[model samples]
Target chain A: MSQKRKLLVHIDALYRSALYLTKNENSADDLVQETYLKAFKSLQDDKEIRNVKAWLFRILMNTFINKYRKDKREPSLVDFDSVEAFHESIQEEVVAPSILDGESVLETLVDDDIKMALKALPDDFRMVILLSTVEGFSYKEISKIVNCPVGTVMSRIYRGRKMLKEKLAGYAQKYGFK
Target chain B: MNCNDVRKYLYAFLDDELDVEKNIEVLGHSNICCGCGRRMEKERLLQKRVRETVCEVKAPAYLEQMILKRTEEKPNFFISVVKKLMSERRLVSLAGIAAAIIMTVYFFAIPGNLKKDDFLYLAESKYHDYMMMPQLDLDIRSQDQEVIVEYLRKQTNSSIVLPEIRDNAKLIGAAMSEINGVKVSQVFYMHDGTPVSLMIICKPDSGSEDSKNVDFSGMKEILVDEKVVYYDDKGFCGHCKIMGWKEFGNEYVVVSKLNSDEMIKILKKA
Candidate 1:
């Protein structure tokens, strides 16, 4: 495929992720524009990128992180030890999954409810969920884009999904869904 | 697989990330365990809901077009030229030499017959030379505008009015110089410790060859107080903004490394 054609194909995905990251339409537009510009300029270097979509996502995430989160430390890959510890804690709790039997409740939730739940997520968790669930990136691909380890990616996905279910549970009950 | 094992691989199973053997084991366990199966279904439903909601946001119709337009607009000309030159190193170097020789011949051979406005080019060159020479000194080294103006007036034998730029700049000195055999008065000022030079000479008559050669072609023009002033877009002398305007039957030119906005402010004040 032509370079531009390949790149432009992912604009919708990039824009959606940008909106999730920025939470403002104008800033999302700016972020996506900057991401494309950076990607195009780097393409001139003639480096062969194996996965252009992942590469573009990497650029978008880097731009968003650098431009907006300059003051904060970068979210690194979840350490293996931490992931193990987190998993152990969850196993110990054995808390009943709030989302069990909530399938019909989830179905009742509209797009706006889902968006509000996603937006309510913390930045770190939201990024992973958006990449995995929304854009369908693999844990390995998410690792590369978010510059974290696969273990960290899995942990974020688990926690992020758990958080989403809890938030949706409130909406599910309010909407009269058993 | 027991409930603990099912719980451990539940997320990986939903994500389709488990190995074939592990995937079958998880499926088997979930089938026998109603609770684990229900939990897996809930997670699947949640993922579907989130994906469907997020997917509702397609890029606005204009976003792709805007991005493509931006890419089209930002052509890296210098990089492309460099790439081409690198690929054709031998031929490009030979062509470069020939082009340089042709330009040199064109400049030197046509100077004698060149029109008066051509003198502006010569004046710009002279301006560069004087500005570069460290030994060249002003005739009057005074901060007082009156002293510098009086000195330049007597030296050039022309009526001179020193511009008021006291708020931001101070007078450095004044001098007399000749450009294309025409006497010119030069005043210098210091703005934030940087030197700016202003050159003044009689406005050439409509039919004069000097006036014809002085029109700076290709420079941008803007009217300040109804007087047309021309300034070089890429900066003229030593990266200084050179602005010229004709006022009171005299042509005034100011050259400084100060930015265009500041230069305009000083010129408008003048």
Candidate 2:
């Protein structure tokens, strides 16, 4: 397949992520365009990209951070030690035997509700959650994409999901599922 | 693995990132422990819901084609050689040969003219007519006037001053375009939900023949900041009113559907 044809397979994925990142259609379109253009240009340098999807995502993310989000306040960084401590603390929470009762609440909540909950997350957590839960990127892949350690990725994903669940808690309660 | 151990690695296990031994231990523990099992199930459900919700966003139909067209191979050396032959006075005989060949295939091969009005029409069509340009894209997108002006200045090798408009107008972005075969900068803004485009072109050398033809014959000239600013209330195109001025060796043209007074107010504020 041609380079462009090969790269085209990931456009939908990239576009979806760009939309979540930008929250505007035109900006998302521009972001994806820049990503693909940069990807194609880099491919000319004969760099072999082992995982094209992850590679494209990394470019999309870097472009977004450097160009689009330059003026926006950056998400505060969490130190590795603090994240590890937080993970340890979360594990000590009483394991509710009835957590499964909330499983059906996810079904009751529509796509928009889930989207709003996701958007409510901080940029750092939201990015990791999207990469891990939605795109199914490995913690290591996400670490490389976000330029952080694997431990940070793991912590962010855990915290991101926790935040998402908290945001949806009211909806879950509305449906009497939790 | 005990419940506490499994809980610590719960997300990693659910994400399938745990090592084989730990993965097997977590699976075994979750199967036997009811609470751990429920927590795993809840995590799985959350992941599924998040994925399904976000997967609904698909690229618009035109996006792929736009990407492909934008990355299409630019003019190669042969076209550059022909362009050079056309430009250099010393290559007059060669230019004659190239022009003849160009004319024969011009209808099908050459892109649209790189003239000043062509660029203006492009800006007008994109903002007003909602058209797309295969080649044109913003080099920088920012609401900050300073950022947009700085970026355009670098691209055009000329300083750019963004006009101040009333009613809290915001800068959208800026792009570099060719005007009269010279690189010029175009800045886009939005006011009351309407788009305004400002095209900045450096004035040609003082004695150049092109400078003599800079005509605003039908446009009404007015003084703003002691500059001879020109305005056309009856738009140059059917839908767009145009205001222009020359300062600091650059010609600035502001185009929009905005009335002459509003456009002039913006220029005066600059």
Candidate 3:
């Protein structure tokens, strides 16, 4: 098979991320299509891509930031300085002990609830969390994908997970999940 | 590490992003400390849940087919035209002598079921084919703008002005071509070491057949220099962005790897 066809192995991963980012199936389809078009174009240049998955993800994120973000008017109002400060605050803040506890919250929580909570996150936080937690990209890999420092990626992932857990906990309360 | 320090490193540890020493320290602390150990499990579960939730979403069955279809290399139109022509016995014998005549008749006479808006797309395809050539075969090759303009005017028998690109791109040459049986002039330039083509196709006369008409009404319109210029930022065919506008009954299209904004700026400066 062609290299472009081989890249399809990551389609599920890319589409999931695209769906969450766009919050619409049609837009996600367009975004993924645009990503593959760009990838194919780059492949034509004969430049060797070392990590195809990470490279594809980078193109997806960049396209999202450039085209979709502007179209949706999703502003990056939270600057890196504030994000760093938020990380510092997270360090000092007391950890809310055991929201999940021994309870298998994942089993009780429906996919929509989890998806809704994740979708509600600010674009930056949602991006890092999706990259780090959901897609399992390493901190360094996410740093390159999102074009930010490793520290920034870590901060966003930390804060993003915290917010997601809190939201999930709220859902559990509403649904009477132990 | 204290409880606070261990909490800080918890995510990195779960993500396997920490160094070996830091990993051991976090692991050792979590092993002995009940609070840290429980927090570790909870966080791990959260990560797993998040991954599992999103991972359940597979791309739709049709998405793969759509992507493959869209990314598939478009067939070379010129080759298809030649194949169709070569399939006929009489055309094969006169192919060498009737190349230009075949082009004129194919574009103007046949109508070929092409939509009115296809005029621009056809021009874009011609530009794509030209760029694919191993070397440019320009009727007139010169860096002098007036010389190229004069050559096009003489070839097409129409006054034409080359749009002044604000960039350091130099006029390389000019070629005379026909689109939809309407005579057109193609001006070539080298911008930042990349070739750019500017095609000018004059609207056919009012008495001209309906098949020869070109349409720009459906394209996204922008006013540059107070003239309504339509642009297609989403490139046509290959990677070439196409921008066209009508002036004094002549349609101007600039096709290049340069983006829409830069192309617009060029039109504005013109």
Using lDDT, give the best candidate's number: 3
**Residue B161's lDDT in candidate 1:** 60
Q: Give the C-alpha miss distance for residue A170 in model 3, angstroms.
A: 1.5
> What's the true lDDT of residue B5 in model 1?
79
Indicate the worst ten consecutive residues by lDDT in candidate 1 chain B: B210-219
Docking class of 3: incorrect
Q: Write the per-residue lDDT of candidate 3 for residues A61-155, one digit (tens) a residue.
A: 99998898677654542332233233344544564453466466656878788899999887778888888888888988997998755655665
Q: Chain B alone: TM-score in each candidate? A: 0.40, 0.41, 0.42
TM-score winner among the candidates? 3
Deviation in Å, model 1, residue B73 alpha carbon: 2.9
DockQ, per model, reads 0.16, 0.19, 0.20
Q: Summarize candidate 3's per-residue lDDT along B19-63 as a digit string, tens digits.
A: 999999999999999988987887787788788988899999999
- Best DockQ among the predictions, by candidate number: 3
Question: What is the C-alpha lDDT profile of model 1 across A76-161, one tens digit per residue?
Answer: 22222222233444565366657436546666777888898888876778898999888888889998898755665676777777
> Which residue pairs in candidate 1 collide?
B116-B213, B117-B212, B117-B213, B117-B214, B118-B213
Per-model TM-score versus the true fold: 0.53, 0.54, 0.55
TM-score of 1: 0.53
